[model samples]
Each structure stands twice: as C-alpha cells, then as structure tokens.
Target: MSARKVGMMTEDELIHVIRAAVREEFSAAGMRVDAPADVDEARRDFMFLRRLRGWVDGTASKIGGAIILAVVSGIVWLIVVGAQAFFNKP
Candidate 1:
C-alpha cells in the first residue's frame, strides 16, 4: 500500500487496520500477539553522541597542531637571533 493512502486514513482507522493485520497474522500462525518487541532508542542516541565526539576530537587535534607549530616557530626564531648576536664580531 502507498504511504499517501495510509496517510489519508484517520488515526483510529489506521490503528484499527494495524490491529486487524496483526490479528490476522497471529491467527494464521496460531500464535498470540499480546506482547510486542522492545525497541532500542538508546542505540540511536549513542550513535549521535559518538559522531559529535568524533567531530570534537578532530577539531581539538587540529587546534593542538597549530599551537605546536606556532611555538616551534617562535623557538627557532629566538635561537637564530641568539646565534647571530653571539657569533658576529664586535
């Protein structure tokens, strides 16, 4: 069945149709449909959190690299200046 056709039905009508389907399925198998299966909402939430964590980790790593580069460049500049000062003739 198309989604549009299902959507056109009222909420009660939809529920009634679903119940009927379930009943028919259960009757065909000679089984009871009293208890439904449990859904894992936490799994979806955990995946969303994990993705955010990855993004934050990548951003932090990039920022840390930039900081290390800036510090190393400054140290190199200081060493070059000190060497030039101490080695040049008076």
Candidate 2:
C-alpha cells in the first residue's frame, strides 16, 4: 500500500491502517494474532464461581493461620506463667 498522510484518513480507514500495521509487526515478530474467542454465559458463570472459590479459600487459610497463632500464643503464655511460679516458690 502507498503511504498516505494520517490526517487524510477517515476513522474507519485509520482503524484499518492501524490494524494492518499491527498484524504486519506481529507477523514479523513470529507472533500469531488470533481473534479472541466468544465467551458464552456458562463460561462467564464458571469464571465467576472460580473466582469466588479462590477468595473463600484464601480467607479460610488466613482464618486458620490466625487460629493457629492464637493457640501457640496461649501455650507460650502458660509456659511462661508456670516457669515464673516455679522459680518464685519457697
């Protein structure tokens, strides 16, 4: 195609020119430019469910870690108290 001033091109013509240039650049770089696949309702729903499950799993792990930390801290406190009482005995 002959080079033309961008200012002379209409909106559609500009888009077409840009797309052609991009495709050429991608092909030169050995990259494939495939159109995106259409996502149907079922696929969208499944994606949302997957995201929700991931969030729930992350939150559950955080809660489990906090519970474990609290249990460990309680055990440490008991050990410290017992040691102090034994050391202060008559």
Score residue 19 of candidate 1 by CA lDDT: 91
Best by lDDT: 2
TM-score: model 2 vs. ground truth = 0.55
**All models: lDDT?**
0.79, 0.81
Per-residue alpha-carbon lDDT of model 2 for 1-90, expressed as tens digits? Answer: 569654676989989979989877866866546444322543676799999999999999999999999999999999999999999999
- Candidate 2 — which residues are off by over 4 angstroms? 1-39
lDDT of 2 at 88: 100
Model 1: per-residue Cα lDDT at residue 20: 88
Off by over 4 Å in 1: 1-41
Error of 1 at 17 (Å): 33
lDDT of 1 by residue, 1-90 (tens): 556543488889989988989877866866555544311443565688999999999999999999999999999999999999999959
Show pairs that collide, candidate 2. Answer: none
